[model samples]
Target chain A: MTRDELLTALFPAGCSIQPGGFGTLRGMAELPGTGRVEIIGIEAGTPLGIEGALILSGHVLDLVAAASRAPLLVLVDTAAQEMARREELLGLNEALAHLAKSLALAAETGMFTLGLLYGRAAAGAFIATALSTQMLVALPDAYPSVMDLPSIARVTKLKLETLEALAQTTPIFAPGLEPLFATGAIAEIWPPEALAARLAATLAAPPPRADTRDALGQARGGRKRAHDIAAQVMAQAAAHG
Target chain B: MNAPGMNAQSDYYYEASARERAQGLLDPGSFTEFMGPQSRCLSPHLAQFNLTGAFDDGIIIGAGLLQGMPVYVAAQEGRFMGGAFGELHGAKLVGLLRAAAAHKITAVLLALDTGGVRLQEANAGEMAISEVLRAIVAARRAGVAVIALVGGRAGAFGGGGIIAASCSRIIVSGHGRISVSGPEVIETNKGVEEFDSKDRGLVWRVTGGRSRALLGGADAYVADRISAFRDAALAQIPNAPPFTLESLQAEQARLSQRLAAYGTCRDATEIWRQAGLEPPAPVADLSEADYAGLSRLPEADHDAR
Candidate 1:
């Protein structure tokens, strides 16, 4: 879906979104039945990178520090982070880190942080912005993964057909919202039509902060070792103490 | 300088393995790995692809003594999948930070040697790193100093770089490079003119320890030797400041000033010049001590702090 269409659907009452270069969108909008909240949404086709991320995350930090403690909603739709020489040279990782830190600071300040993944949330873009939120929801149509199949195939030196066959049985190598949901990376796979309502409910009563994705992944049989590894580390730590 | 009774070959931080790095950084014989390779806690995701996984999932997390002070240590093994964080790898990091916070460990030293989240398990890896960030913040809130040392072949990139930033302090060696995206990724997407991935010198100049320090992204620059890293880590851990609103504000101001000053900069040389430094000696030629002597974060009012 286009940025305008998604924003309109999500905020029917109207939102103030301004498009920046490289598919970046910035602005603020009020949550349904709640006070004004800050919005940093990246349209689906946008190729997010260091410069765009800095602008988006800067706004988040500004809004969080503002007098109003309105919740912050991060709209994700980017396919990948811009892989440019200038960005890497300029320390894209640091820019991405800045974004993560901003979101983290927002959560630390007791501001409600919600992420709505509506499109392709892949790799670095997903890590920098979306994953840090207190509550993260994905639309059914969202394609969230680290790297796409072709890229994965290239990196692993495996045939695309082989990876595709593997993805069919294991969500581990699959691309889409369902596989992500199986891993518990996504809190819910809400339909596009119900996004606004779901968001409203989320903002009204933000879920308590906890890292339960590991357990959820275990229960779903997608990520078997994460929970157990974390448990072992904790247990060992306790034992040492 | 080699540690007492250690071979000279192990002196270099870049040459050390993740386990060796962890053991060498801590006081002699003080390192007790929590889930060492013996634990067999490998990445299940890699197993699905029929790939052999490291027993510790590429990261070593445990408790140890730094200068006789109780501390926690976590080091990433770059040889294992470029030290990437898969689900299990990332979980171990998050678990370590969380434990450090709970135990109120006096300090936590992280030896970062990854290119960021493992692409195979991207979402879970990202989530794990995010959890680690939260835990780092929590540890800092509880007065536990969190320091990151980046000096491995992979350096620190992608989510790893971000995680390093979130730490209370960052120490980098001359050979270490830290950035979000790798050079090859940039070259593939932006064309060779944008960033020639083959030009190692150019890559280092742009994202190397010297540039990161000058850019206000790193706190200290040390020699490529493990002893230097240990010394720098020791110097900072004892009195590492708590993460407070005021300190965060100061950091925010510093970062903002960096963007304002060098946001438009394309060349690392120009950045150094603009930051009021002399035409920099080749970044590769500068010793850690020499780099440390140079002014860092020139845009910020360091004296005020």
Candidate 2:
């Protein structure tokens, strides 16, 4: 189905809708006349540069706080942030962190957060949205990794020729589902054909653990020590308190 | 000039390489490395996309001593992807910090020299960095002194800047610059015509060591010289052998005041000047003895009221 058709089915019958930045449909979706609001929207990366991600994140936060939603639906179609000298300098990482904080704060304050990574889920901007949520569903086409090749060569100082040879065998350093899966950094990787079904299933399931991402790491053997460490930290804090 | 019998102090000393800096920042030799060069944790994503590089994922994390003080140190190697943190790199950092906190290490020093999260590994890198932040916060709760040392050429830009900002104490070299967004980003987002990224003075004025120090972001500003950094680290040891929430809260409050003062100034030099500190031009030119003399000036009344 087309993007709009997918969004139309997700919205409540009477909730008003409007176009947000990047041509994504945004509006409140809730049961009729309840006045309770659930901000729902879809965003694309091709427009707004990568910096647009921050703007999109900010708008979503404002909508949620203004509407006081219990669960928020985020539909992502980012190919990743634009690679520009300016984006790096403006401290996109902090902007990215700010978005993460918003979602976390919302989660702590009793909001259900879900993300559908419809496209490229590359870089911090991409991860910030999905990782901060209770569940993340990604389309098969998504190409996720820390960065591209030339940038890596420029910084790591390795001869590009050498990087090519080594990448062939090492999934740990490669992008896509392999590395994330190995690290248990991602909880679930869904196919494009079955995304809708998966999303419905996840939404139907009880809100998973506070951070299923950490548990996913252990269950999948991607990240070796995240859960244990988090537990240790909490234990220490509790003992002190 | 290199005569064998020369007793010159310069002859006996040599500058530390990035690797050596990473090694020496910790204990004499207690560093047990994971995913180091031998482990070959180079980025698979970068290579898949046709980038080339070497070493253990562009970061160095291990345990060592800082003046008999047991500690864990993470030195970001900017030479590698601007010292960006990718999946493995971030994992290593988070893992080590986790290890340190779990074991209750005396301190954690981050010799940050990054442009932030590596782009090739962007997705994982970003998550890893956030995880590390949460980890540092957790570490601090266990009385672990977290020191962010920013002196290397990368100067802790990008996401690394935020991580540095959240540290218990930030130790910076005069040449270092720490900012949430780098000047280039400002120029890009705002416009190059409005701001110049090439202006060294402008960059320093905005985020340099003296600026950070005056702004109260850096707990102390030491000379760019490595020995000065070592000395400053030693000085902090006596006062804070173990990190505690109360101690960190006090430091955080102090940092808040430092940040607030920036609202009233345009440049670090001006902030320092207002703080009664000798400006950087003169301070940078001062001999070790002269600089020490200036540093010993009666403590200014800038402490939070």
Candidate 3:
């Protein structure tokens, strides 16, 4: 069934769902008497940063600051942040920082930040959502990676034919839900049939005290122990210096 | 000191020499290049796989001045591996940012033009970008501004897009395309009918300046000229500060409204109209700066939220 169909079935009594408008960052939710928000798909490159995407992302944060209320549900669908020449000119780092700050602020406000990766989530987008959430649920089909296949080819300059072959056996070069699973970025995968119920249950739950980005990192064997590894590096640097 | 055959400056402003452009973009004589061609920090993985690598590890990292404010800049050299972010490439960038933040520098400018997460050194590249993001977060928390400049045919794609999105502010030239997957990947996955990679107009609408501007993804859209970028960057750097929760929540509300208005729109013009701009022709024709000036969300609008 289509995602719309599933939502329709779950919200049979004429529920109100809103779409994110252009130049507008926040999505509102009027749940009966309560004013709940559903932040769907804070993806990258939704902006046209002729110079860079990050500058616009910072502006997006301004829009986020405009929104009121907490306990939002962020449905994540970004593959990564924008990395165009325009984005660089506009300051990619600063743009993404805005979104990160927004998410961090949301997480700080007792906002029940639930991440639902309905599609792809990689790199900065993954960090943006995961860093702010208590836990993240990935749809089975969603593919997450730091970068995608062809990009790997372009960056690595490997023959397309060779990279395609390597993608099958190597999780490092390949992008998908399975690789993300191997990375421990995902806490659970919700079957399409169970998506609506799971989301509803998540929305009903309380906000988590701590973010799971570092935890997920350790869980996936990517960094070993978040700051533990970073601590090691810092200690070594300090000793050497 | 012009080279024997080379003009003091190149003809195509957008495609000018990366080094020359980087030098010219900042305050005169302010740039102190790190690594540089002299460093010979080319990708080790490149020659092992028989691929060529550029000197300075395919990225130019150093310090410069933007209007006398101390700024650290990193520019990707697209000529090398399409400016892929390799281990050394990412490390140089991360190191520069870490130092800049540690020193309490005022700003960081990243001139991005690459397909992110270099596959030859994919693991290190990915880790590096993640670290950079964390670094930027730290910098922002401590009151530093980061600005990304997107100008070049290579534009930004893949992981590069996320890096752009993470910045505190962004400036884009008309030529850039910021997206997770360039048209090729979208076409491969969604079919040619959904997105023809060759369709310049379609590609622009998906990730181009006008589309992103309407989407509120870019803070300012500059002309293809480099000076335009300098002006926009200068304007944004001063406004950088850690935002309060109310401000962030407001921005979130605005994004939600924006997606609602044009999430299904077929044309960039349509999105522009919904964003309170005069329809297609007018918005499309405005110069990058003029459009940005007119398009900023009004104070009243912010208050209403």
Candidate 4:
């Protein structure tokens, strides 16, 4: 979908957003039932880097300093952080950390935060921005992964055909909204037409940021070991104490 | 092995296993590992790919005492998959951090030596790390000091790097390196001329403890010895400030300044000079003590901010 289409679906009543000076979208808009919120949106095909992370961080910092407790709406659509010589030399990790910490601060302060993955939410960019939210909702077509399939194949030293065959049975190695949803990384995958209404409901009553995804993943059959491992850890701690 | 109460005399922080590091950092006989190798909480994803899974995945989590103060610790095993986080490993960390906050632990020490998310379980690893971030924030909100110690050979990179930065305080040994993207990835994408991943010296200058300390990414620099790390953690954990709006605001400003000052620079030395440390000491060559003596960013006054 085009950027305008996605924005309209997210904010049906309309919102004003301008270029965030780094190919990102940032602005303020009112939700249907919830009060106004600051919006930071990354375009679908663009790459995020130091500039983009700084823009997002600046917005979060401003919101925290403000008297209003306006929630932050993060719309993610980047494949990954920009992989360039300049970005690496300049410490892109620190830049991304700033963004993550800003979002974490916002969440800690009781400001509702929501992440809507409209397109690609991949790699460091996903961790820096989208993963910081209290709740994450994705469109049916959203693509989320640690790394793309080709990169994964290279790192694993496996044939693409073999990996693809494995992906058919396991959500762990797959890259799509389905596998993410199965793992409970995404709270829900809503249809594009219903995104605005679903978002309003989620904002009104956001889920607590508890570590329940592992259990959810187990129930969905995407991950069977996470819940058991956590259980063992907790049990051992209790037994020792 | 030495007696349970006797601290090993050698510097084992770099070569020791995750459990050994945890045991060495904590007070003698005070460490108690949960979900250890006996629990067999290995990664199921690895088995599917015909890869062997370590019994504890790649992390060791438990409660311990640091200088007599109650603390929870999580140390990643660098030898096992480069300390990557998969579904089980990430959940283990999340559960431990949650318990730390709930139990009102005095501090939470994370001995990180990772290259970030596991590639075999890409989606699961990413999600697990995300949950781990949330848990760390919660623990900090509860007034628990979350300290990250990056000293192992693997250092911390990718998602692990971001998690390290989210902690209340970061202490790195001279050999530790931290970055979001590994140098090899950068070299592959941007060419060797832009960033020679094979040049260990250049890599260290870009992401090592010294550079990270000078750039305001890390809070302290210590020697490569385990005792040095333990001492640093003891000094900071009890006095570390809780997460507050003012402190976060200050952090925001500091990061903004960093981006503004070094965004265009192609060399790590230039960043040191921009920070007003002209005639900068060679970061990789300087002793940890000398590196810590250099001029650095002013400590954030959470209350004053």
Candidate 5:
């Protein structure tokens, strides 16, 4: 979906989103029942680089400095990070990390930090934006991938055809909303019809700050023992560390 | 000069296994691992793919003492899948950090050595990194100092680089390279003229530890020895800043200024030259002394983090 279509549907109550750094969107929106929320987002398919990330991070920092702890919604729709020498040379990792850190700081301020993945995302750019949020909900048609199957095939020495065939049924390495949901990377899939209401409802009562994707993944059976392992380690450290 | 400490120790961090690094970094016999090799924390996904899995899943997680100050330590074995983060591998680190916060442990030492997520288990691996990031920040918010120690064969690219960058303090050795995408990935995405992965020296200059340190991407540049890392870790433990709005603001400014100052530069050398730290010799040709002596350069005000 286009950014405009997604934003309109999600904030039909009205929003004032302005074009932001390099390839970003930032502004404010008011839901029907919920108070104003700061919207930080990326333009569709724009591979996020240093400039865009810094600007997004700056927005997050601004939200943290607000007098009242306001909710922040991230509209993530982008490809992976720019694969260029200049981006890497300028420390894209640090830039993306800073963006993630800023979102983390916002979460620390007792704000309801949530991401609405109405478009698509992958790799470093995804982690810096959609994946960094306190909770993530996605549109049913949203696309999410860590690495493309062709690239994954090249790296893993598996045939692209084989990878493609497996991706259809395998949630572990597949790229799509359903597979991602199965892995619990996406907390919920917002129905297409009631995005604005969904936004308001989610804002009214957000999930607990404690991350539970692993537990969700475990329960869904897409992942195994990740939650148990973390719990065990927590238990051990409580007794020993 | 090359050895920095001149200890002439064969305890090269790049050569050590995750368990060995964890053992060598902590006080003798202090580490009590959680779900260690004996526990066989293998990767179910790798097994599903008919690939053999490492018993420890490429990461070592547990707690030990750093300078008699109780801390949680986790290290990655670069030999296993180039230290790529599989589901269990990422979970182990997350577990360690979460445990640190729960126990109110003073700090968590992270030895990063990976090219980020494993493609075989991409969904789980990617989600693992996100969870790890959440865990790290959560631990820091709870007053646990998370210090990343990087000096391994893999050099912490991709999500590994992002994780390292998020740490309260990062100590990188000449052997360590940190970046979002590795050279080959770039070469694949953008042509070889942009970045030839075979050019090892070019890789070092672009994403190597010295370059990362000079650019303020890393806090400290240490020698490649495990002892050097341990010493750096010991030094940073007490001084590690708690994750607060003020600290992040400072970091934000530091990064912004960095972009503004060197954004136009096409090469890492340009950044170094712009920072006014032109070495008398090229970094590669310089003796160990010339290379490891970056701290002697003018300290940037933003280096406090």
Candidate 6:
């Protein structure tokens, strides 16, 4: 779906998002019955370099500076972090962390936050943005990948065909929305239909106070050991504390 | 990844095992591992790839004391899978951080030594990184200081770099490095011209601990000694503030200033020169004491542990 169509569907009342200097989406939307929510996003199908990431972060800080208690709707669509020496030399890792920490501060300050990932997201870009949100809803178009299968094949000395066969049996390392869904990284697989009502419903729900994807992953059968192992450690640490 | 100037005056933290680092950094007899080696929290996914996994999944997590104050700690073994975060390795850290938040531990010391995700369970490892970031924020919000000590051979790349940045403070030795795309990954994907991974000096100058410290990416720069890290952690943890909006704003400005100042530079040497920190020799060749002097770091006293 096009950006306008997605925004219009979510905000039947209409949104005022505008493209920033580098393709970052910013502005606010009037959500019926619940009030206005601020928006921050990376434009679809673009690599998120240092400049774009900083602009995205600037929007997050703007919300905080306004003392805005409105929910933050992060529209994510990126080809992931820009792969360049200058980006890393300038500390892309720290910049991404700054963005995530800004969002965390927004959440801790009592504002509800959610990310609508509607395009491909890879590696550090995905981790520090879409995954940093309080809730992540994957649109039908969402495609999240870590290290790709090709790279894995090369590193492991396994044939590409063999890797494909193994991918069918395990979603743990594959690159698809459903695989991410099974891991509970994407809280819900959101269809383009009825976007307005669905968002309103999600906004009305109580905010999450703890990260629960591990439990969700276990229930979905994509990941079984994470929750149990975390619990075991928590239990043991609790005993000593 | 240790710099050539690394001194023999100190026991090399770069060569220590995960457990050895953990035990040596904390109070004697005060470290009680939650999932010791016997727990054998092996990565279930590695076996699917026909790879052997370690009993502890290359991370050591547990409660320990620093001069009698209780804290939580995680030490990653750089030798095993280059300390990559497989499903189980990541889970162990997530669990430890969750416990740190729940118990209001004084601090969470992460001896990070990772090159990021293990390809065998890449998705799980990625998700685990997200969880770990959230838990670190939570722990800091609960007034628990999250500290990272970096000096291991693997030198914290990719997701590992992000995790290290999320902590309240970072202590780095000249041997340590932090970056999303390390030299090897950059060179492999891009080209030798983009980043010559074989140019070890350039690699350190770009991503090494000295560079991070100079750029304000790290809180402390120390000797490659376990005692130096212990002392720095001791100094920073109790004093680190709870994660706050003001602090975030301050950080935002610091980062923006960083961009405005060094954004166009294509090399770390240019960056250091702009900052007026270009040593007479290769930054890597500066002695620990001389570099520390350049960095305004006081001489570290021995036997702090």
Q: What is the C-alpha lDDT of each candidate?
A: 0.77, 0.57, 0.58, 0.79, 0.84, 0.84
TM-score of chain A of each: 0.93, 0.71, 0.68, 0.93, 0.95, 0.97
lDDT of 4 by residue, B1-305 (tens): 12222456566578777887888888888988888788788787887777999988889989887777788889999989999989888889988887777777778899999999899998888887887877887888888889999989889988888888788888897778888888899887778997899888888888888777766677777877777788888877766756776766776666566667677777777776766776345767766566666776453222211
In the predicted model 4, the residue pairs found to clash are: none
Interface RMSD of 6: 2.5
In terms of DockQ, the best-performing candidate is 5
Which docking class does model 4 fall in?
medium
- After superposition, which runs of candidate 1 have C-alpha atoms over 4 Å from their true positions? A18-32, B1-9, B238-241, B287-293, B297-305
- Fnat, model by model in order, equals 0.57, 0.11, 0.17, 0.71, 0.87, 0.80
Per residue, candidate 4 scores C-alpha lDDT tens digits across A85-199 of 5676666776787688778788767677788888887788988877778778888888887787888888999999999999998898688878888887787888888878877
Could you give candidate 4's fraction of true interface contacts? 0.71
| DockQ values, each candidate | 0.53, 0.11, 0.14, 0.65, 0.83, 0.68
lDDT of 5 by residue, B116-209 (tens): 9998998888989999998889888888999999999998899999999888899999889999989999999889998999988888888988
Report how far off residue A197 is in candidate 1 (Å): 2.4
Model 5 segments more than 4 A misplaced: B1-9, B294-305
Q: In what order do the candidates fall by DockQ, top score first?
A: 5, 6, 4, 1, 3, 2
Better of 2 and 5 by TM-score: 5
Model 2, range A26-91, lDDT digits (tens) per residue? 565554333344554445555323335445555555654554645676666555444443333233
lDDT of 6 by residue, B1-305 (tens): 22111232335688778887887787766779988889888888887788898999999998877877888889999999989988889999999999998888888999999999888888899999999999999998888889999999999898999998889888999999999977777788889999998888878878889887877778889998887888899898766756877777777776777788888898878987887666777778889878877742111111110
Range of the 10 consecutive residues with the lowest summed lDDT in candidate 2 chain A: A85-94
Candidate 1, B21-56: lDDT as tens digits: 888888888888998878788777786667888888
Clashing pairs in 6: none
Best by TM-score: 5
Output candidate 6 Cα RMSD.
4.2
TM-score, candidate 1, is: 0.92
Q: Count the backbone clashes (under 3 Å) in each candidate.
A: 1, 37, 109, 0, 2, 0
